[model samples]
Target: MIKRRLNVLLIEDHFIEIMKFKKTVSFAEIQHSITEAKDGAEAFKILEDKSRMPDLILLDLNMPKMSGVEFLSILKNSEELRHIPTVILTTSDNQKDLEECYRLGISGYILKPLKYKDYATKIEAVLNYWSLNELKKY
Candidate 1:
């Protein structure tokens, strides 16, 4: 069954890959409006706009200007941004990365090297879980 994609925020330095993956793999399969950010700095800026706060944040590590760790550190301390669930979906499969993300209170962590099909599956799962929780709070 085709699913409506939720509004997703993807924070990656490489915009092309994000766009191509979104289009080619069909995050739009679930009909998601994927908002793109070039780096952690840009992502933070977008978060400031109350109307643009994303339901799920897909963050990448090892970015230029502002790294994902730096952003996570900042975010966890901010009451305004802390409630937004940010997932570390990055190439750093290192244990340290995973540990740090959990310590910073990330909602989830995903390593790279994931198959294209699996990537879509994970994305779909995140959307579903978020939707369920949102409904539960009502």
Candidate 2:
């Protein structure tokens, strides 16, 4: 088993999907930690903590209290968490959502109900291809 190195934050409300994702993105090989928050409010708390701050965040667009868009807006506007890259991991395929996310400066987005067969590969690609410095200039 690969030891978790990076602490990944997942801000998804769906319990089943979250559980599935946790299992799919294994500690083996990938070697990254996983943290889940049911809502944007909780995610904000995680981001607020300098120690709990994750290298990456997997966010969902539709949620209770604070939506992904709302959270992104706040984070982008916050001096402390603005630099952290957040990837929208939602089922919304709407162009508007996509456009808004890009405008808000998200690192990337991944659709859910992920096929077990290809989920790991896609995640690996996302993690492997992720570049914080390149994202800053965008």
Candidate 3:
């Protein structure tokens, strides 16, 4: 299967986590465009530009300014943004958080694994699936 190069928006707060994700992508040798946002507020600013919207969003539940749930709520409510596929990439294994994310119409929810290899594998699978799957273009 031909792997499509995806435009991805990664909404995360921790600098180390961000670097880890970038390193994974680089190590995996996946040619993808990744946009980073420190928090929901920053993500919102980036999302405002419809012309440059990402194909997929990887959101972290814990963030400053606005939590992932809060961000998801607003995004899901917006007709213009609701269709974009958002997958939660979080360490929280709380059932409530998982249920809430699904209730808010998240595309997928994945817990960050402790091991770097495990994390990389999960990320690779996610990117592969989304890249191969058909997405709605607005």
Model 1, residue 6: distance off in Å is 2.9
lDDT score for candidate 3 against the true structure: 0.94
Candidate 1's clash total is: 4
lDDT of 2: 0.78
The top-ranked prediction according to lDDT is 3
- Ten-residue stretch with the least lDDT total in model 2: 129-138
| Ranking of models by TM-score | 3, 2, 1
Q: How many clashing residue pairs, candidate 2?
A: 1
TM-score of model 2 vs. true structure: 0.84
Error of 3 at 110 (Å): 0.6
Residue pairs with backbone overlap in model 3:
none
Score each candidate by Cα lDDT. Answer: 0.76, 0.78, 0.94
lDDT by residue (51-118, candidate 2, tens digit) is 77777788889999988999999999988788888889888999999999999999898876457657
Enumerate residue pairs that collide in model 2: 2-28
Of the pair 2 and 3, which is ahead by lDDT? 3
Stretches of candidate 1 off by over 4 Å are 1-5, 24-29, 135-138
lDDT winner, 1 or 2? 2
**Per-residue alpha-carbon lDDT of model 1 for 15-127, expressed as tens digits?**
75586457643644455567889898888788878886777788888899988999999989998778778888787878988999899999999765457677666666766
